[model samples]
Target chain A: MESQIPRSKSQLPIPDYQSSNSATLKVDRVTKRYGSGATEVTAVQEVSLTVAAGEIVLIRGPSGSGKTTLLSMLGALLKPTEGTIRLDGTTLSELAENRLPDIRLRQFGFIFQDFNLLSALTALENVALVAALAGAKGKEARKRAAGLMTDLGLKERLNFLPEKLSGGEKQRVAIARALVNDPAIILADEPTANLDSKIGHEIMRLLRRIAKEQNRSVVIVSHDQRIKDIADRVLWLEDGQFKEMVTMATDPVCGMAVEREKAAAQLELDGVTYYFCSRGCRAEFEAERRGQVVGDRLTLQVGRP
Target chain B: MILVAFRNLFQNKIRLVISVGGVALALLLILALDAVFSGVEQQVTAYIDYSGADVFVSQEGVRNMHMASSALSASVASKVKAVSGVASVTPILYVTNVVVADEERNLAYIIGLPPNAAMGGPWRVVAGERIPSDGEAIIDAGVAEKSGIGLGDEVKILGEEFTVAGLSDGTATLINSVAFISKRDFAKLRGDPGTVSYLLVKVEPGGSPERVAARIEAQVSEVTAQTRPAFAAQERRVIKDMSTDVIAIMNLTGFLIGMAVMALTVYTATLSRRAEYGVLKALGARNGHLYRTVLAQALISVALGFGLGLAFTLLLAAIVPQLGTNLSLLISGASLVKVSLVSLVIAAFSAILPIRQIAGLDPAMVFRGK
Candidate 1:
């Protein structure tokens, strides 16, 4: 029995601005499962999505919503049990396990929440390694990595190890490493989960700029709503299903979702009402506006909500 | 890739030192034991090599000078001298006895050579005369130093006192310290002046030792003859057989210890950096690349350890002789090559567990927040 279901982006209703011909990634009704019969668990189910070049797509969901599993499938790090994933028009599901790494090396870039830099290597070496693995000569790989780091404002931190760098600096180095190979699509799983809200927003803005200016497609899976504004489109997920397409604002100082009507603290900046999840986020935001130094202690109060 | 491996290894300075130190200690044990055995073998054969005799004539079934006793009639020396290729014949008598000097008893081999024999006597005389008369003896330098007996000192051999006339260098053998005395004194001590231990034969200038030995054996029906090199080899074989089991146990222990140390250090290093390896694999590095990185680390550690072990063995070789012990240390290029090959094999084997760990890593784990 063949049931009629929307299996691809073309069969669904997508906004005109996102329906571009240059689709860099196309995931069709992908389902991923683990274990056997009675213990069988589906991590992601019947998920279809498309990301075009020069687009920033954010997948937002709570914990256990299959956002990471879906990202893993899209990156080819995990295979889908019932669907196909295409990156740059190459069907990843049909490729053998040994052959998939080559596709990953040339076509995709991954950014993790922890900024998974090789602890033994310096920032430049960490970035240059990806380029070297992608078949660039040593000198050229180093040059490319250095250029990317400089572009990302991490030029002075090139020789710093990951443990020595600040959280913001480490994430920037990770971003440079992801861009070193000029990958067609960038996949970030909770890129700002460990950063201060200000720094997280800065990283999100950098990613957005990369998508808009360099015409590279970017996909980020995160529960942090602070970064939602920068995305061209947002998909909300729940319990291994795509719940809806929704728009929400996030506290710029705390990275929490803020319902405009119920926000405890709100301020008008540049004729826009910025909402905050708590008085603490609102105070930190105001301190920055007043040209005062906001310490980490002030940021810690962001959890008061 | 190699650079990454090197960086990872050196990242923990303490771990690097401990790993290298463990391997070095194991290598030191192996090399020291081997060198001591080699030194003992060399010391046992030194007398045969330095005898200056083209051929040696022993009793009919005697193969080694140290293990078996050989006695021939002193009259056979004239008959051996008359053989076609024999230039000279020196009859000698050997007796293992304890020498008492200053109330200290030391085991010594009393080698009685003919007083006027030009060959088969101490080649290096550090003091006094080379040959000892009827009531005098030439003591090896090692024994003289150990016993505190200098020239003119009276030492009792078999309860009969004899004056030390000279000191000989490098004449000590594995079984006992050598003391040179005249054949008359040895015959008087044994109560049979007509019998001698063996005969040392020197050949004509153009004669081959093997050919001369064959000629002597054909003419002397009651004795077996061998070239000087063959006799030295026979002596070495006896010493080797005597200590082979102990040496084998020591070598096997050292090898096992070295392998264990290498495996543990490499395993620890690999396990600690498992997350980093997962990141590399997530970045598209193949399993072969990670294996090479681990093997490269082991190779570097083993190479450094081998060099340190060699240096330590050389130091032991220089110091052991000065300590007044009979233990000799011989470090040769052949032994070094053998140890290095074993170390390399150990290093390669140590990489197996670490490689297996890396192979089992799930690259997706790098994405997990923890």
Candidate 2:
């Protein structure tokens, strides 16, 4: 099978910001585990990737495939159970807990699905707050925030509160806030989840422009396929590890995306194969389709990693 | 950070008002109760405080007048008068007993004084004469008004009838009032030939009452001499000891309710903005910075409440007496200090739960949450 690890073929230039030690993210076989003993659960297993300045890497995976865990570890919000995560020159795991906040402030920018702007502050103040936290005095913080918002075409809505802004406008403000502090990388979690398709694609284009022009690396964890063409590299994650190739199937019972080969259960009905992420989903589907399921084929297998 | 903290409040104006109002009412409860307590103390020591005597000579082992009996020999009074720096000594007979007028009974400290006594009678005779002759009584004007007994009304003291000849000001309290009668009638009724309850001593000009008291104690036998202020302090202490637990429980209840109101207000305020706090945490605001912001909010609430409560207390102090209740309330500097400290504690502890909520907040929520 041809490898599905796709890279952008737009002939767009990826500017290198190595001159500023602030712009590189390296993950070395990072693993995240929750619980211990009999309850031990691995969320992400030895996933390694390097994000370079001006490069946009989009990690797409099935539900519960540890995309968020990887993003969190990459952003210094969570420490990996094993292996190393280095951003620029600093190893995040080796830094004291108190030191992580400043590093996150100066090195990472985060855009969220909900827009997460403080509802009390105006759109401009929302962006200015991050700069202020990094010790930018008020006038300077506001000036920098205004400059970024103006660049994002939100100059007229600077004083409008988040509630007063539209979904598209709020996302633009969020993008401005993310770029306000000139962070080395922007980590966005499902940034388009709350927007209409048009606005979502618009935000994607904006993020792409930001990456190239600012020479900033962006790590976006999103399941929205419409934004895929904007990423420099797309990695398909299955069972917490990068998969070279996989076909995703929807679980009929739970609406979860599952890789067909690794599903917990499968049945062929009407010459169509149905995949389920868990035994519970399969059992529930069978019960619901009692009269209709004189199944042509049925299979149960140990779930794959 | 301060502006952010203020913005936290401005976003929830109703909650801000509720929080400030709750704390203000609580502090008002405490301050109003404390004012009554202060007034009681001042009233309890009124006679001793206002008496012209610089020193008091009581029987040894009797340190205060309230609920205490002192029987000093007449000879001790003579020696107190003769002590160096002693200008004059007026020996008075006193007893706490019931006084009845027109079938209305009231408790009174009935004092017996000699005719033309130097300073033992009511200091301010608001209505009638200063020293009452035999069978004539000087009663507190407040008690007279409350009992419906005016000057010249017949009153009974220790089973002896006396005509009310005078009305004294500021000598009535919640517990009892002071009434003055003649020493001859007191000695006649009691059949005690040569005993005085206390010697009211006046020191010569420029003489230190403390030194005079010391000299009197040295020169006189079987007597404990104390300066007027010292004696008044003991009297106040004796009364305060009787009511400490009652006042303490009241003040503590008010403080706890006030603190809880403050805590609840601050907690809800913090919880209402939990998402924003998450955003701040995710944006790299440290726990220390967030804690300070929340704490500043708490302090602002308490400080505003304190100012409001104090104003209400002073307003009451200015207006309540006109309404004609014996409960005279006033605020003191020392009480302000105490309440200020309590207000500060309210501010500090009010932030604890909110800080915990912030401390446990995950910056990851900005990514995972809405």
Candidate 3:
């Protein structure tokens, strides 16, 4: 009975661009304005991007560079002042507002840099909420979220609130929440910006791994160059215009790439192999490697370059 | 997300408490006023119902039973009794006179009931017995208690003397606090033995009160036969007219104050949590989700306030005896339901502008702290 099943192309779990050719997201020449006349200012101007299935794209920009704006357009959170956003081949501009929440709930998952977790909910509850919103029953969602958190190494912190969690732990919880729906596209805005360099790399690795393993697109808005290498493709934006696109490479230590000649930190410990992104990170790694007693994993400050 | 909504409300305990307290106080005032107004109305209608007369025959244009200016001579009753379907008619004499006794005297209405007249006699007596003879009086417990009078005590009224022989409850000239004397004594006190005030007429069981009233008015010249219910309606209209301007101003002021409090509560709650709402929206919460979230919070606050106000109204009536027997604080089912509906509508309506702010948030600016 183990080998009796015949796998059909439709039954396969692989991501297919031809079948999902509906273009999960498209933002074309989107522009936005606030206020009027003398007081008016443009926030997002003439921005366009498209995210297809099975693609991990990074929207890179500094503060006020409108990377968040472009991500919002893709997520259907905002209506472009001049252009349209198409999700799964349907232009969002033409959709009625009453149907917006339904589209967002069923089609997209959002992750934020600040880890915008409702402080009142526990970590497990937060992830469970997204699952339930995506149509899983409450109890089933909670059980699945618990299993996902445990797999993400957050078993001991399941019931803890966001306020009680560390920067890295909170981002991991957000990641778990974003993946709860197995959405076609995951929109993340600076998901790793709040964590330290070491923890930041861990989060990027998780996002990239999910992008490849689960075959779902994760479009992130970030100024953190540390995550530039892990992305499948890096999209550069300056003043709301797409500058260029570059291929990414994997970091040696964590097997996650950092673009623009970035490297994961490395450490030499008791004749064992380890890696770090910079000398300071390597020293910190060495200190932790030596200071640790038998069973516990040691932690130290590995500052971002 | 609604679960997140509930969590957010509970997170802001101080704001919630203030909102709830303000709402409760407003509700209390509304309920208290309604209760008193309702109680007064009930007390008036109850008196009319228990009077057992289908039609009250008074001088034309008379407004109420106890007004000094609204009197008719005793001859009107005999004339009214002769009208068709009129089973019995009794003359009821009402006049205000000063009572003098042991250096303690006060102005009190002296009501006279005709002998062997079922239509004009004390319906309920709380002490001693009904007036037995001429020169004897049945005193209202309210006046007896206030005037320090008892059975066998003698009092001189309008140059005529009488001894208190019984006490009656629910009998008064002004707001149920008058003295009852024999019709003979009343005539003597008023220095007029040939006249009385208004007639109370009982119609045959099968007769229509309105038809009998019309016939009596037609047959008896210069007299009006008011069916009891219609008369009660007129009484309310008269009282409302007297206090119309003041009550109107009071109600308008109360309504504005209630709206202002509700608006401020909703506004403050929304403003203080603006950044939080922005963050929620950035995290993919739809505008409708945040709107419903804020609306639910307001509803819960209003509901809490309504419950508190109802309890407070009851407590006020219980603690202050003036609001107990005579001046009741009225909270009817209709009024209670109306108050809650008003609160919800106000809450829901007030939340609109704030939720628009949440909806219009630029996720980019929100994330960058711009």
Best by TM-score: 1
- For every prediction, compared with the true complex, DockQ reads 0.50, 0.50, 0.29
Per-residue lDDT of candidate 3, residues A1-93 (tens digit):
000111222221222122222235777788877678999767778877777666678888666766766676677767777888777668887
Query: Is model 2 an incorrect, acceptable, medium or high docking prediction?
Result: medium
Off by over 4 Å in 2: A1-22, A138-140, A150-159, A197-202, A244-305
Model 3 residue A28 lDDT score: 79
- Where does the lowest 10-residue lDDT sum fall in candidate 3 chain A? A1-10
Off by over 4 Å in 1: A1-23, A247-305, B173-175, B218-222
Give the Å error, residue A226, model 2: 3.5
Pick the DockQ winner: 1
Highest lDDT: which candidate?
2
Candidate 1 lands at a TM-score of 0.84
Report the CAPRI category for model 3.
acceptable
Cα error, candidate 3, residue B208 (Å): 5.3
